[model samples]
Target: MEFKFSPLAYVPFVSVENMIKLVNSIGAETFMSELAVAIEEDFKRWELFDKTPRVASHSDVGVIELMPTSDGEMYGFKYVNGHPKNTKEGLQTVTAFGLLADVDSGYPKLLTEMTLLTALRTAAMSALVGRHLAPKGSKTMAMIGNGAQSEFQCLAFKAVCGIENVRLYDIDPAATAKCAANLKSAGVNVVSCKTAEEAMEGAEIITTCTADKQYATILTDNMVGDGVHINAIGGDCPGKTEVAEAVLRRSDIFVEYPPQTRIEGDIQQLPDDYPVTDLWQVMRGEAEGRTHDRQITFFDSVGFAVEDFSALKYVRAKIEGTEFFEHLDMLADPSDPRDLFGMLS
Candidate 1:
């Protein structure tokens, strides 16, 4: 039996190779800047989206998570995993894929590789928040834990927040060298430092992005100064944290969702009832961002699902007239309604 599939059965799919091509074609800095705008648009209307913490299954080795969200009109989700040991085995510490669907028909509209997209979106969101909370006239950023995410963080800050100098430091000298080399032509001053404190010197914005599965203090209390905005992104799961308890207590912490941040972010080190500001409220003008130049501001980012939804939405729009994706026949469309089994035969 020859079966004809309807156009609805085909969904646009962006593979990993194609995703790389798309980023290169559009330019990484421009892509992240535009993506930040999309994420900000969603953040302003944060009340309209369905929100929850990502569902995660954890093990001694790593964790696998599903992040899902919807804006009443469109639904999206990303399947991702984190394994710190993967790097020792010559594999990525994190990888992901995501899908966007139409709410009316519940049919998938787009599917794309999200590993690269996640890095882009995470950096973009960090820089977006920096633009709001960092001290006025901020130019230098301290990039701690130079790894897969370091260069992207530097470039995103340069593109979105107008950061001009990025001081890089990591436990591994090779990693710092790799990051500096990659950012050589990225239009920012790349400074390699020996110690974390050295990196933070003269830096107004400090971004910590280490990959460890345990409670580790990457920043101590005395190390942090007033009038600095801390973008803490490395500690994103239970038992994995980067900042010290004293530092969190002193800073005015802002989070994406309290329920989630209390469990997964650097704020996890604080008491459950500890007060924190919501980033959405700030975006919506309901809460204050940076009140005093001498005050410390902290952004405890846990990578919310709505941000991923926004990134997927941005990719869907950008790839409309471009050859950055292919049609994937992923649904069953029987010529006769309700005859799915017959079409299979």
Candidate 2:
């Protein structure tokens, strides 16, 4: 008799180099578009997931977080750390990795680098939510923080929301310069602005993604107009926020998850009972978004675990029949089911 078995005993691992190659092979714009679809599909089925706020261990300097979720079949989680001052030492401010596992067998399926994937899925989620909440014909975007995630946001808006012009600004002029330089060939009109107000000129979408940990106000009440949409990305985690509390009071707020956003998003500055539309409800057509053209809309994004689950699942499907992943011998297999000691011996 011939014996044959599948490669189910091993897990697949996508390294940093392979993740980069996968993104490049898929094209950044197309990848963002597909990722948006993946995120939306999960959001539409939000009720099927087990959701919770990311577990975080905070310190005076930075934080480490674990975001986990499961759909009763596959489970995924990301291990991430954020240290804003690390860039001064020529290191990334944030780094991450994630894994997916089988729920029935409690076996690992995939392990992958999530730093770049996080940036991509975050931008994809912002643009996706913006598509539903932003005003009609929003072509220009003001990206206030020109850090590692700036360029990805610009491209994501272009791919997902049809944004044609991106205005860049940062406290560090070199950061703005780098963002602008990176967007030269991205097919969008890139403008480096001297101030946040200048960056907001003629821009219909305002994205405040600064990396400060304090309760600093990046977008004042006066800066936001009546019709524009605000993507508040920077103010994640406790004691961190980008938009002014006054601005929040006047806007139609939306969130990924209320429990998480209350603790980790810009809405943390608001009252615990403040009303907000869950983005999943809007995606599922159970709730409304952007009812009027003059109504201000805010997506208080805190990076949900479901988005990571969707991203991991998408990568898992995309890497099949491709050489982008390597088999990791992480699982133990014994020839005899009840002879674990004998197999080891």
Candidate 3:
């Protein structure tokens, strides 16, 4: 007898190709803006979610991590890896996949390629924070370390925070050129600079995202002037940092989760007892974001799991009335709950 598969047996899978189509269909900037709203909503309810530092396994070459979180009803997790040397071998420096499952049933619901989703969610997160923390009426932004993430960051700020000009700089001229070219039609002025200092000229928001798995200072204290919002997203793991210690001392640091940021973010360079504001609290209006005009607001971003959970939830909702995903028969559901062995007959 040929048995039929139950609807519960299939899981919705969003492939890389479909994800690209979905982004194009919704427009990248709009997608990220919507994602930012979803993330901020989650942040408002931050206390209800299960939070922990991402579980990381480090090797000499790179690191692999599992970021997991749940809001008591829906559970989500992302498996990601960061290998800076992968670019030398013509591979992505960061790649990821994520899953969402029902908390009560413990069955997988949505599975999607988070590599693209991660980039969108990360840029959205940065811009969302910028909307709150960056200096008021900020227009120009200096983007250091132009790479796969640079274009998305530029667009997110433009769409969400009203940034008009983006000055780009990278160690590699080719990378700068690539970023500039990608942003040509993005409705923002892109300036390719030769040096990091040149890029920071007249910029209010500075974003640093260099991919080096070591302690490196992408921004010194002197480079960061008063009233600038620093989005430091590069230093994501232990021993990998991007800002100078002096810079950290001068800035009012904000982070997603303190326990994780202390271990992995640029704040890792500071002492254990150093004070940093929680981003969730700021979103919930319990804490201040930018107190004064000259007060430097440094966002030590290490890519938190809750943001990924928000991204997964956003994708799950968007794919409901669309064809951007496929149903994968990932579970074996027997017609009779106790007749699992008889399904094959």
- TM-score of every candidate: 0.98, 0.96, 0.98
lDDT of 1 by residue, 1-345 (tens): 232588888899999999999999999999999999999999999989999668899897998999999999999999999999999999999999999999999999999999999999999999999988999889999999999899989999999999999999999999999999999988899999999999999999999999988999999999999889999999998899999999998899999889999998988888899999999899888999999988899999999998999999999999999999998888888888788789767
- Model 3 clash pairs are none
> lDDT per prediction?
0.93, 0.92, 0.95
lDDT of 1 at 197: 98
- The runs of at least 3 residues in candidate 2 whose Cα sits more than 4 Å from the true structure, single-residue gaps closed, are 1-6
Count clashing residue pairs in model 1.
0
Q: Candidate 3, after superposition: displacement of residue 152 in Å?
A: 0.7
Q: Model 3 lDDT vs. the true structure?
A: 0.95
Q: TM-score of predicted model 3?
A: 0.98
What local lDDT does model 2 show for residue 175?
96
lDDT of 2: 0.92
Please, what are the lDDT tens digits per residue for candidate 3 over residues 22-52?
9999999999999999999999999999996
The top-ranked prediction according to lDDT is 3
